[model samples]
Each structure stands twice: as C-alpha cells, then as structure tokens.
Target: MAKVNKRLAVLVGCNYPNTQYELHGCINDVVAMKDLLVKRFGFDPTNIELLTDASAVTGEGSSSVVLPTGENIKAALSKMVSQAEAGDVLYFHYSGHGTRIPKPAHIFGHDEAIVPCDFNLITDVDFRQLVNQLPKGASFTILSDSCHSGGLIDKEKEQIGPSTYRAASSLSYKAKNIPFESILEHLTTLTGINTSDIGTHLLESFGANASLKFLTPQLESELFDFLKADEGILLSGCQADETSADMNPMESGGKAYGSFSNAVQ
Candidate 1:
C-alpha cells in the first residue's frame, strides 16, 4: 500500500431538485463519504470539497461547499486535481444518477456518464482526461454509486469479474441498454435542436467537447494513456449491464438510499 502524504476528497451528490429525475439518497451518500474520509482516512476537514444540492441544508458552516451543477462539478474536480502533488491520495465519490450513451459510429457498444443536476453529463473520457492531470506518484480513486457505472475509468483492468472466474483474463459481459429517447432529450438541451441524427447534429452544434463526443473515436493511446501512467481505481455500484437500485423502503425509516451506497457505507 502507498502511504498518503496528503489526503483530499471531492464528494458530489445530487437530488435533482424539482425535476423528474429527483433522487432521495444522494445527499446522504455524500454526507456519509465526507464523514468516512474525515474519520477513517484522516483527511483534514478543510481539504475536502462537498458539492451537492443540499449545500444550504447540510453545509451550514462549511464555506467550501457548492451545488452539483455540471459547471460547478467540473470546476471543483479541476481544482482538486490541480492542487494535488506527488504521494498525495485523492478520492472522488459520486452518488447520483448515471446514464449510458450510444457509442459513436467507429466504436463498439456504449459509454457511461454521470448525470449532473442540470442534465449535463460528465463522461468517462472527461474523467480519464482529469486523471491525466495528476502529478506522478499521486493516486486518484473514484467511487461511483450510480447506474451503469462500470468501466467508468475507461480501459482499466478488472481484478474481479467474469474474467477472474474464467481460465484467462478475457471474459465478455453484455452492457445494459439505456433509452435513446432519454439520451436525446438531455443531449438536445444544450443545442436547442432535436434531430434523430446523433453524430452529425451534435458534432456540428457542440463540436468535440460535447458530452456525446466522449463516446466518439479518439486516439486510444492518448485517451487511455492514463492507465499506463496513473494509479487510479474506479469502484462502481454495478456492472455496465446492470441497474443499481435506489430503495426507499418504508422499513428503513422511509428514507431513500442507493442500494450500493448504503452497502458501501
């Protein structure tokens, strides 16, 4: 195990206030993670940034808290990575909604993305890009408690899976299908134009940085290059082909909780 000279965390939780995608336990999930980092990992309270919709409710005295909008989340992540140095341990925990977008014409299957409160997405490519910014000897760990979160770290090897059970390292698993209608609605929000054509329209309107372009073909060497240089681990709630349950059981004090988040905490 690598000793951590410095400890930092960026925890984001979203309840999608007043929206159709409202969730109940995301804020609680972040709270739990914040507590764990403070007590279990010995992270300084000042070194953690908690971004969530419940900032007003939970962040009474914390000046560093903010809402989990796409812009805010991205900026917080950038700051966390920018401030890290060698031998530091940085942990990012996201407890919220996730979506699977259609892969580009050149690629096979799908790509995974976390849904921000604004419905703007942060995809796996974006994460790998962030990981690339880490200084040597620094480690970045991601814990995603959301739907379709598997492979969020992009081409990182699997230590536990069908591959581990099989004779060799290669094992195939089917990815879950996310509705195109839902994906299109969210993607079109930025461009204000809706078209059945995904590739051309998104490319023309939003260009490369567009959320959907994360699935588009890129130089594998550069996009996945962090796997070679960085110590990053992604612990997802469920497999790519599985749905994670968000349970609000009456027996559990009528409070909602992500099944995976509750289990991990």
Candidate 2:
C-alpha cells in the first residue's frame, strides 16, 4: 500500500457536565472510534485526541478533555483544524442529543435549528462555515449519532421526520429517515440511474443488506454507494421513522443501544 498521510481524530462524548438535558453517548462513541482507528486502521494513538466530560488536560498521546458546551467545542475544533495540513484526514465523531431550532436567515430562510450544546445551536450555515474553513485536499469525515440529522441531506426540506406537529408531543423530530431526493438527483445525473430506478434499487438494496439490521437494504446500499463517491459520508442510527435507543438495557451509566456507537464498539 502507498504511504498514508498523517491523520487526526477528534472523538467527543457528551454524557457528563453541561449537557444534562442531552444524554452523553459521545464519549463512548469516541473511544470506540479511537480503537477502530488504532487497531483496525493502523492510526497512531498519539495522533488521536479525545474530549469528554470526565477527562483532564494532558497534552499527551490520545488524551481526553471535558467540554460542557458549544463555545468550547468551537474553540477545540478550531485549534485541532489549525494543525491540519495537506493530505491529512480529520475524523470527527459526535454522539449526543440533537435539538432543532427555527431555520436561520442565511441558509434555510425559515425557522429551523439544532442545538449543538448549551451555549449555541448549530445551523446548516454554521456547519458549512466550519467545512469552508478546512484546508483543500483535506478529507473530513463526520459521524453524527443523533436525531434530526437528515437535515444535512437537503436545505429546502428542513421539515423531515414525521410532521413535528403530530401525535405524542414528546417526540419532536422524526428519528430514522434519510431524504434522498438530492442524492438521487446527483446519482441520476452522474451515473444515468433513472430516478425511479434509483429509488427502487436503493429500497431493494437497503432492505436486503443484512450487515446493518436497523437500515433497509436500499438505504444501506445507497449510503454505501454514496460514501464510495468520496464527497462525504454520513451514517445515521436508524430510518427516519424509527427512534434510536439511547441506553442499552444490559448496560448501566453507559449509553443504550440504537446509537451507532454500539455498532462501532
């Protein structure tokens, strides 16, 4: 294999302080991702940095620090990305509760928002800003183990997941559906897959793929194929209609199942 460039991993778990409202599964997810990078992908443990609610400042190999809110999150991200250079791969993994806010004026031109932490809500525009800050040729991989992430799929339809106004007032957002209109559009033009055929193929493949029981084969295949395109990869926990479990009944003080963290573990 050709020599691989240096890689930096940022793993965050939000289960402790400052995030009481949102369950913190980020720490576990980060730890599991770290193990995968080191044991399976040959990444040097020294290159990894983990931030959670329980760690201290060590500045050593794969150290952990506690972050309670969004301000701290932005600062840490800025610092880490500053160290990134060409040919570098930056892996960002976040596991926690996701809140929606009214859409921002710049992107959606409506009222929809997702709270990233106690201090601030992360809008699509905010995410785009972060992405724009990255150096060219740098690969950015983001895995979000939370609800309402389908918002990343398209800006036009900010209202995904069963209409937020329906029954069971406790459930605010739809948990497991990925709106693939844009993805289908892109694939259709690029690969000549008819839109209708694309949907059929995606459905068939997502439903049949057994590796991930939570996702239909068509969705799975679409996501897998989409990731292969190399633009960006997003792996959510469940379909838009389903709710991902947060606490595994078998474990205590640790996050539950339905989180992608369990799969990564």
Candidate 3:
C-alpha cells in the first residue's frame, strides 16, 4: 500500500445567486465538507482551498476567498497538482450544476461538464488532462455532486446518483442542471453572437477563462499521451444521462441541500 504523506483538497460550491440557475445548498455543502475534512480526514485547513459564492461564505474567516469561476477553479486544481509528489493524496469536491454536449460529442459518447458560476464549462477532457499531469504515486480523487457528472472524468463508469425508485417526497427539489440550449441562449445573449457552437460563444465571451478542452478538442495523441494506472479517481453523483437534485428535505426545517451530497455526508 502506498503510504500517504500529505493531504490537500479543493472544495467548490456555486449557488449562482439570483439567476435562473441559482441553487440553495452548494455553499452549505462545501462548508460542511471542509469541516468534515478537518475533523474526520486529516486535512490541514490552510492547505485546503475553498471556493464558493462571496455572499454565502462571508464571516467564515479572513482568508482570501476565491470565487468558483472556471479560470479560478482550474488554477486552484493546477496549483494543488503542481505541489504534489509521490505518496501524496489530493481531493477535489464540486457541488453545482453539470451539463453535456448534445452533438458531436468530444469523447464519442458524451462530453460531460461542470457549470462553473460564470458558466465557463470545465469538461471531462479538461479533467483528463489534469489527471494525466499528476506525478507518479500521487493519487487524485474527485467527488462531484452535480447533474450529469458521471462522465466528468473522460470514460469514467463509477455512476452513482439519483434513482427512479426514489421514495415519495413533498418538499421542493431542484435539478442541478443547465441544458445545452439554456447555456447557448445565455452566451448568445451575452456576446450577441448567435451561434449553436458553444465553444465559439465561450471563446468570445470568456476568452482565456473558457476551458481550453472545449475550445480545442482533445487530440488523439493527447488521449494516449498519459496512460497510467491508479493516479486518478472520480466519484460522480450521477450517470452522464442522469440529473442530480438539490432538494429540501422534510426533516431539515426547509433548508435545501443536494440530495447526493446529503447522502454522501
């Protein structure tokens, strides 16, 4: 067994406040996960980077808080991976909406992605690239609590999310989902460039902030570029075709939370 040396983490939660994509429980999810990592797992608070909505995580501390934008999130991941070595363990947890490409799938089946607060997508190809960069003996684990997140790691099959056999519930439930059409509409409205090509819209609007994986499709050489074993792990909330839920449980006094995240905790 590999003797783990240091434990590092990045926790992201995006509520997208006041927008049509607004969620109610992601902030709470990251905060709770932070506490769990500190108390239950052995993660140093200083070594972990927490990203979420500004208004939600206020009064938590005086540390420099970063918003969960695509650029910022990617930067955080890169920073953590850059510092890792053999026997080190890294963890990433995302609580937010997820999406998938409806046409010309990048990886052949579906190109799943996580929708950052700014709507700049971080796709499975991006995650694959990040994983390929990990140093040997370094283990990176991802826990994604978002809709259509199962394929966030290219060709991942660890599907575990919502089920049709869900017990009856009267409380409100919000799907942590942003359809391709909605994303296109939002981008078109922002850039005034009506095009079905999401990559073009993202490139026009966010530029460098947009995920390069989407902007530039991963090449065949790149796919075979980093072939290693046991360096990366993905624990997604649902299959590529499924949608997770942000739900208000009856026993929680009406405070909403992610169904998948809640179950995980």
Candidate 4:
C-alpha cells in the first residue's frame, strides 16, 4: 500500500428537529470548525465531509448538502479508516446528543454513544473497532461535544481529564444519570429491537462498583474488560458522569450552540 500523507475530516452535527431534545447550535458549530480547518489548518475544503441536520453550502453557488443518516455516517467512517495509510491524519468531530448505553452482552463496562440523527447510536466500541483498523503510523483524533462523551473512544487513557465543571457563582449545572434502562427502551421504540436482556440488565443494575457482588466469571468479564486502541485520542466535552450543555447564550444573539464546540471554535 502506498504511504499517502493526507488529512481527512468528518464533521457531524445534529439538531434533532421537532423533537423534545431539540437544540439550535450544533450545525453552526460544525460550520465554524470546517472554516477553521480550511483557513487555519490548511485542510483542503474538498477533503472534508460535513454532515448535519442543517444544509452545508461550501460556496455561494454550490448546492446545499443533505444530512447524513446513521448508516451513511458509518459507511463514511469505514471508508475513511479503510483508505488511510501510514502518515495519514483522520479527524472526527461530533456535536450532538450523547448518552450511555449498556454494553452488549459480552462486554463489561457501559458504552458511551453519540446519538445520531436517526437515534441509532454509534458507540465507543464502534470507534475503537475503527481505530484498530487504522494502518501503522496513522492517527485518529476526535472531538466530541456532547454529553457523556468522556470515554467515547473506549479504553484510551484519559490524559486531559475527569475534570470538574465550575460555572460562575450565579450559574449552576447539575448532572443527572439517566438509567440505562431508558436507553434500551428508546432503542426498542425506535427500531423494534429487543434490547432488553432481562437477566443481564438486572445484574448490571446491582452496581458494578459494589464490593460484595454475586456474579459469575462471565459476568465479571462484562464489568472490567474493554477493547484497547492505540491510534485514537478523544477530547470529550465533559467527564463521563457529567452532562454537556446545549447553551443558548446571550453573546450569540439568541442562537443555541454546544458550549464545548463553541469554545473549541
């Protein structure tokens, strides 16, 4: 294989329209990132793929681009990674809703997943799998501006954080844990898949951190093992246990945007 020196980016933003979890700033965040990549990083404009609920028009006369579905996003990522050779740089940026999903039956920890426009989650396990496919000397970096994104690349060591979020004295942010059960229910509702393995769900609920636990060796594997990847790094918006904010700040003149994404831009 030819060792090609290329820089590729896949930027995804989702403002879930007509839904209870609607936000106003995700697409804007990706657009700003694209501009930064082109003007500052010297990334070729044609090499970037913009996927968002809103239209992306590269030039005045260019046609508006349609949003990507979950399958489309997966296919793009697969192609991006599969095409990489040594000395390639792959960038993935996501500004959207994120949540925790119970790891599939065989894996022990919970999965941190990005919520796609279609509600089909792309989990950290998926990302790790992709990173594993990267050729030697290739690198993947991800910036996830979403909730529960800390471990978004699976077993990678957290070099920057587990940092605490401290807003000004007047502003307060509280973190809440949504039960994994609810996520399973949402998945089932959306795709009619039987996500509930009742026996395993009950066992996982008993606190994986508990000292006195009754679980078989197989169950133990579900709590402590993860796929390790050496080629990817994740910069997440919040600690795994915290929630990222979708801010509608006054400075933006009444526009909603992801606070982390705005800061990065």
TM-score for each predicted model, relative to the true structure: 0.80, 0.57, 0.89, 0.77
Model 4 lDDT tens row, 186-212? 545645545475223323433331111
| Clashes (candidate 1) | 1
In model 3, which regions exceed 4 Å deviation? 1-4, 58-64, 105-108, 157-165, 218-221, 249-252
Query: lDDT per residue, candidate 1, 178-258, as tens digits?
Result: 355675776677667757655544565545434534346554446655355568788887876556656655454566667
Question: Tens digits of per-residue lDDT for model 3 on 90-179?
Answer: 999999999987656445566789999888899888888788888988899998999988888875456455456857777788899999
RMSD of each: 6.5, 15.7, 3.1, 7.3
**Candidate 1: residue 223 lDDT (0-100):** 65
Candidate 1: list runs displaced more than 4 Å.
1-4, 59-65, 106-108, 162-180, 187-190, 197-221, 225-227, 250-254
lDDT of every predicted structure (CA atoms): 0.70, 0.49, 0.83, 0.69
Among all windows of ten consecutive residues in candidate 2, which has the lowest summed lDDT? Answer: 208-217
- Model 2 has an lDDT value of 0.49
Top lDDT hit: 3
lDDT of 2 by residue, 138-195 (tens): 7766666665554432222333244343233222222321223433343355556554
On TM-score, the leading prediction is 3
Q: Could you tally the backbone clashes for each prediction? A: 1, 29, 0, 2
Candidate 3 pairs with clashing backbones: none
